[model samples]
Target: MLTYVRWYWPNDDLWNYEELDADRWALRHVELRGSDGVFLAAASLAEVLTARDSGTVGAVAEYERRYGVVPEAPLPPPTDALEPALESVSPGEFERLWRDARRQLEQQTGI
Candidate 1:
């Protein structure tokens, strides 16, 4: 099982974090959206948290390349009223939700 959490930045940007497990709290997937609620990028939590250049272009860079502007950086782990409680979910359920989100984004953006 895994845990999913969401946070809203002050700028109205959103962050989705998937944890390894409910008890562990180690991050897995991290997704980012713009203030306009556009899907900007998705990457491993390590990638976003560490800001490490893995020598390969990441989703964030690709998004910037396609849109011609860099999206806002992932803010530090939310510790205020911005964060909501973690929701536990099975791995398969998480995958389904992720796929659905991608499909919806594609339909909305036509990309």
Candidate 2:
């Protein structure tokens, strides 16, 4: 089966898309292309779908949402050993951290 999504590319303020082919339970492949039908990259199907579902826009928002924003100063890694604990961080805490990290980034980069 094949599916297509109309994707919005904020960089050039243009519309682009991905051609997804599903075979049985998993995706076959994903093709990323520009509005003009030029090939951009061959990306992972799951990764592409996740971004599409997450409504990601812009470089910073995409990175910050997919991966936590980088801190200005080096910070120690958590000492905890459980994966579930990390997943259980409260939504409020997550928002606060993102906001603080973004603010710090803007200050450092003067964006």
Candidate 3:
């Protein structure tokens, strides 16, 4: 199962770190999302920790220093009534849906 870790700092800053596995910790496919829930960056664990990028490195360091570890339990599900439970989907269906959503988003934002 996918694992998610989150950190909320001062000034309403927040970040979501996602990894495919935690047991054999690695960041090969890790994803980082910004406070606004926008995709920020994807990098290996080593690179993120050792890179000179202050913002990203600082965030990670603060999270680890305060939290004591990485890849903690997944955040609780949204409490909104409209939120749906997790569901499984076939790869083909997922790809189609993802593509459609991307197309719609690009059309709306002209990105």
Candidate 4:
């Protein structure tokens, strides 16, 4: 068997949950395991980072250091019922979606 990895991009300062407006995402080999004939996922960090909201990964991670937790993050907003990619989504709709996801996370996590 093999372990897997997941990467995420979070909006806000990645510091304060209060700053967590929660928009952004990306995929990376944040983790991994050795194995064969199973599954594999790989991509350039730049490519993955591009999906991220708008911060350099280092900055975001640094912010998390003092906060004790990364900002709340969910998937990017959908453009419409037919489209769910950020490239397709309107700016306003994306903002709303980010806020909504954060609101939901706050309610559930109580953070």
Q: Cα RMSDs of all predictions?
A: 6.6, 18.6, 10.8, 16.1
lDDT ranking from best candidate downward: 1, 3, 2, 4
Between candidates 1 and 2, the TM-score winner = 1
Residues 69-101, candidate 4, lDDT per residue (tens digit)? 322344334444542222233445434433544
For candidate 1, the per-residue lDDT at 10 reads: 43
For residues 1-111, what per-residue lDDT tens digits would candidate 3 score against the true structure?
A: 534333343343434233434352534322223444443333445544554355564776643332224333333455746433423334454344334433544454455
Clashes of each: 0, 0, 0, 0
Residue 76 lDDT (model 2): 19
lDDT of 1 by residue, 1-111 (tens): 655555445455655545454454544454556454455433344544344355555855554333223223433345655545545556675576456555654565578
Model 2: clashing residue pairs? none
Q: Report lDDT per candidate.
A: 0.49, 0.37, 0.40, 0.31
Please estimate how well model 2 matches the true structure, expressed as its whole-model Cα lDDT. 0.37
lDDT, residue 76, model 4? 32
Q: Residue 58 of candidate 3: its Cα lDDT?
A: 70
* lDDT (C-alpha) at residue 100 in model 3: 46
Indicate whether candidate 1 or candidate 3 has the larger lDDT.
1
The C-alpha stretches of model 2 lying farther than 4 A from their native spots are 1-87
lDDT for model 1 comes to 0.49
Give the Å error, residue 95, model 4: 0.2
